[model samples]
Target: MNSNYHISSFCKIKNNEVSLNGSVIYNNENNNFSAFIKAAYKSLETNYAKFFKMDALSKLAFLAADVLLKNEHLNPEEENNIAIVFSNKASSIDTDRKHQQSIQNKEDYYPSPAVFVYTLPNICIGEISIKYKLFSENSFFIFDAFNAQHLLDNTNSLLSTDKTKKVLCGWVELDGDDYEAFLYLVTNKGSIIHNKQNIVKLYNT
Candidate 1:
């Protein structure tokens, strides 16, 4: 297999702003996560109704993936060749708290199926897969911090094999008001070499 894989493109979303390839493409400092993401969705001008219903974590990942893959071309025939490897410090705790609170109050014990559905961190990955129709392998890892080396290893393992031609990997962490998402598309085509150093550098940028 090919030894040299590159990060074709990367997108960062945080602090009410969205950046592509380390450049700020969208910004709205006045709103919180919910409003900011809704504005970002409107900016895309693509109608995906389910976006509004998704929990905070899902929305964050979905928007980042949308920005990363919006202009990139993918073969529909080879949909199964694309893989998603995502990691986060907090695994859907934002929604987990909501689910927990919903049932904790005995008098107002109203368990919400919608909120319960997104309690799994991997659900964000599933949302992205459904949008792109990618049927390949997908994994969500929970790390104490941004483990770039681990991410690099996971990505390399997939690309090193013939099973996957491209992998969308990154750190997407969201906890309450504090949130950050960095997603990159990795493949054999691109200028930036996909290595541990570069991954950490790009993620910081």
Candidate 2:
């Protein structure tokens, strides 16, 4: 896919949350995974019920996507040309840990199907699509680190084929004692350059 769409803007939430051309959404001192999850959820919406219902990975994706979309003022339905391409390192290991723990505990040796369903990395894409009603091509890739060249090449191929007019691509990784999500909204209409250098510069800035 040779996509011409440029990333108009991006947002990231990590140990110390950061945003491109926007304010930091949240900065929590608790340093607990649950605390980070709660702060991230609050960054997305005021409804706590909805927040608690989402799995850990889903919550992370939602918060990152929500912040990016809000900053870009993007409506997936209106555009009707948006897609999501997410990559991660841990690949839902956190969920897997919990599931394994459930079965390991003889007293509570029952694995909840709900929790097991989120073991796949793509679940985050599903959650984001459902939340934004984006019925476009979505994919989840597992990598060792932030592979900017892979992202650029893959996105370019996807866009070149006219399969998707816009793309939301990023690295959303989570694991024990670590969590980070960086997302950018790329569109065919913008001045932003689409290359490894620009991608690195964007993230660095």
Which parts of model 2 have CA positions greater than 4 angstroms off?
1-4, 43-49, 74-79, 106-109
lDDT tens string, model 1, 44-93? 66468999889999999999998887758655345546899999988999
- Native RMSD of candidate 1 (Å): 2.0
On residues 1-205, what C-alpha lDDT tens digit does candidate 2 reach at each position?
3335677878887775645544675777667777776865665563536657677777778778877766666564563567899998889999999888777875766787888888898988877776567878889998888888888887887788888878899898888657788888787776776778878787666
Taken over the whole model, the C-alpha lDDT of each candidate is 0.87, 0.76
Best by lDDT: 1
